[model samples]
Target: MSERKPQVLLIGFGGVGTIVSYTLEHLGRAEVTVVSRPETYDSIKSGYRIESCSYGIIDNYIATNVVKSTKEGYEKYGPFDYIIITTKNIPEISPVVDFLEDCYHESSTIVLIENGIGIEIPIYRKYPKAIILSGVSLIGTTLYEDTVKHIARDIIKFGAFINYNLDKQMQYDRCKHFLSLYSNDNNFAEYEENVKLTRWRKLVYNTCINTTCALTDLDFGRMDLFGGMESVVRPAMKEVVAVAKSEGVEIEDHVIDEMIRGEDGVYYPPSMLIDVRNGNYIENTVIISNVVKYAKRNGVPIPTLTVLDNLLKLVQLRTGEAKGRFELPEKRPLPEENYQIQFKY
Candidate 1:
């Protein structure tokens, strides 16, 4: 008899979530159930039209099952073999540990396909015995309504997150099994011996390009139009490398140039920029502030990152104010001369 397929529960069915679910179902290796927010549940439940450069256009793509919340997912599909979270790593708004309360089990392996460094710490602390796999995806995909556009790369590097509570060999074995199910010809996957280093490498881009674009409200191509590559992008990336070095992660200077060249002419709206446009809180803490804290602990100076972090905090404040998530005293009205300055332009 054929072995039973692994049962998987995936949370946050956005661009990354959609790609992961589609790939798992497309390969016919796993039984996938997704937990999406109530707002987008109906739309996603109907179907998705995926325009993928790697896998070609796929019409009416749907998962094995779709549910609204983690509670519903757990009640319907309990004892899941793998619980994958591809949600935005906004701990203040939605903590990662909250999602696992209902679904997580002793046998369940938690897979984190989210961004930012130090993302797996909280989960590891909470579920010490659970085997956690960190997935670093370099794919550039965006979801518009019911359509998902996989524009650029499709690569994911997976490694077992360091958990002293669990046996190292067992964690690696689980990671390898998941890799076998996820990787295919077009959707490339590789094993990473040191996932923390991989995360820091990706942060070299996220902390620099992603934050810069959100602050300037520019796409990849447009950022280059204003000489941001040499002025802002590269400098911030160098700071990231410095901080990583202090933590004993060696990232060569050439990686910076290679990353810049990779998106040389592409017009891509990074996830952070998209959040800004939608009046959503930017991932300031995980993506930027965490690195800043690291730099401080090791006495590694990161002036560029410091400036970026401060600016992003202001951006986050603006988003919070716009969304009414923050309550502040009414602003004093501007003087008549302040209004008149607009006409001078």
Candidate 2:
């Protein structure tokens, strides 16, 4: 028998998926198959386009196959080596969980490249056979009918949550498989060890920037100049740091604060803000309520987080969206402030 070429199935053919598809195609390592709703599939098959503001050109991408949501989406294009998901977390994750159950397998790896905190464990509980990876993306994409406007240089950080230390070669092989999709451009992917901290750190930054920008209806550039935003931002960061500490993870306040300032302090609108602008479901429960729960558990008072959580709840209530499906997790009290601000190297 002839050797088989590597294959990848991309879920959520929205902004991020388009970028991944563009990069993977340019790299030319694996055959890409996109699984999206029917309308998105038609657009990709007919000819999907990407116009990059920074990169300076509109390019068209054609995938090997396009199928709407069905077992056929997986059955026809799978036994895929990797499934890269960029979908948002909503409705307590029922739809995505069902999708994963239908599509996940031991031979396939699922990489979550989306927003929010505290989502991976539930996925693991449901799909233990598949290798799960969590990632943080710092790229921006705007949609424009059968095309996405790639707004910034792609900065993707990803890593797996492996249970045991596998042999070096096995680990390297898995890493290599992932890197292949972005090999043509080394700027897109980085393998990180402190992946959980990385994810939480990014979330903390987003929670501040996205919510603030959305509320103020301003972009990051102007928002950065606004006075007293730090009062809200710093307090939220403290809650995030406290939660990380409770989980035995140490994250510096300055690191989180600086992270809130994006690349060159670029005035980009965050995903949450984008969702609110689009009138879509927001991640109030995961991002806001979780912080409140953790702070209450640690005996650390998060006055600002409570306020923000209440504000988010008001937004949901006024919009008549899904409210509080996730039960508040048990609280873990934080120790007294005996820590010094250790400078990050």
Candidate 3:
């Protein structure tokens, strides 16, 4: 008899999701069942043509199974060994915990491959018994229509989210086993003993550079053109480092410079900017507000992050209200326009 491959259920079908699904199946180590929306279900079910810089061209790829909703996936492929979530971490519209309620089992090992800081707290709180592996992925993959373009680096650091309720050794073993599944020459995967520190390090880039680029409507190269690196970017990163230190995670001072230098000449658009462009709500809570929370707890003054947080809240409010994600407020008529002076250029 042939060896039984591990059964996996992956949620989300965006750029990151596509790459993960392809990688999992490429080695034939796991049989993946994907959960995607009904709108793009057919297109994804047909196949994905991936153009990865690391893995080269992989034509006409599809998962072992594709389902529309998490409930459906659970009913069809219930009690999966591993459940990986690579969706946008937007809690207002949909919480990651809600998805788990539908498919979670006692033995399932959950893996989070999303962005933002402190994202694992809620999950760990809810599923205290289950082993949760936190993943910090450093890849630049974009899904446009049908094709997935893997643009930049492909590296992921995995570590177990500390759960006091579970055995530490068991958590470590599960995390290591899960990490082993993604072992391939095309991508880099490693175990991080202090993954939270890894997360804080990434936040130095996400909280500062990603948020700044989104708010200013510019890419990395353009942000550099405006001297943002010296003025706002570096200072904001320093603030992030301070916040991380407050949380007991000591991020190196040189990481700020390294992060800035990483995007020196690249014109890449950060995820927050892409969300703004797509009219989707930015990840304000996890990316910024959570850090602000930490800073306030430790009495660390983060004036730059506070200002950025307020601005991002306004942006999120506008986007959320437009999308009807929030309760509609009482509608009122606008005040009469005052006399306006016309100016000729």
lDDT (C-alpha, whole model) for all candidates: 0.87, 0.68, 0.87
Q: List runs of model 2 lying over 4 Å from the truth.
A: 53-58, 91-95, 163-173, 260-267, 296-299, 320-345
- Write down the TM-score of every candidate: 0.91, 0.82, 0.93
Write the number of the candidate with greater TM-score, choosing between 2 and 3.
3
lDDT of model 2, residue 173: 58
Clashes of 1: 0
Please write out the lDDT profile of model 1 over residues 127-178, one tens digit for every residue: 8787889999988888998999998767999999878887898888999999
lDDT tens readout by residue for model 3, 130-224: 78889999998989999999987679999988888988989999988887888688899889979789899999999998889999999887887
Overall local distance difference test of candidate 3: 0.87
**Deviation (Å) of 305 in candidate 1:** 0.6
CA shift of 162, model 3, Å: 1.0
* Backbone clashes, candidate 2: 6
lDDT of 1 at 174: 93
Q: Candidate 2's residue-wise lDDT over 1-345, tens digit each? A: 955667777787777887777677665567777887865666778876778754456566777777775377678877788877777765343345666755666788777777766666566667654566766788878677887888777887777765343444464457556875664543567877677777778767766667766666677767767753575676677777777787667887678656655567466666667767777667777666766776687787777778777887667554443334333225533457454322221
> How far in Å is the alpha carbon of 157 misplaced in model 2?
1.1
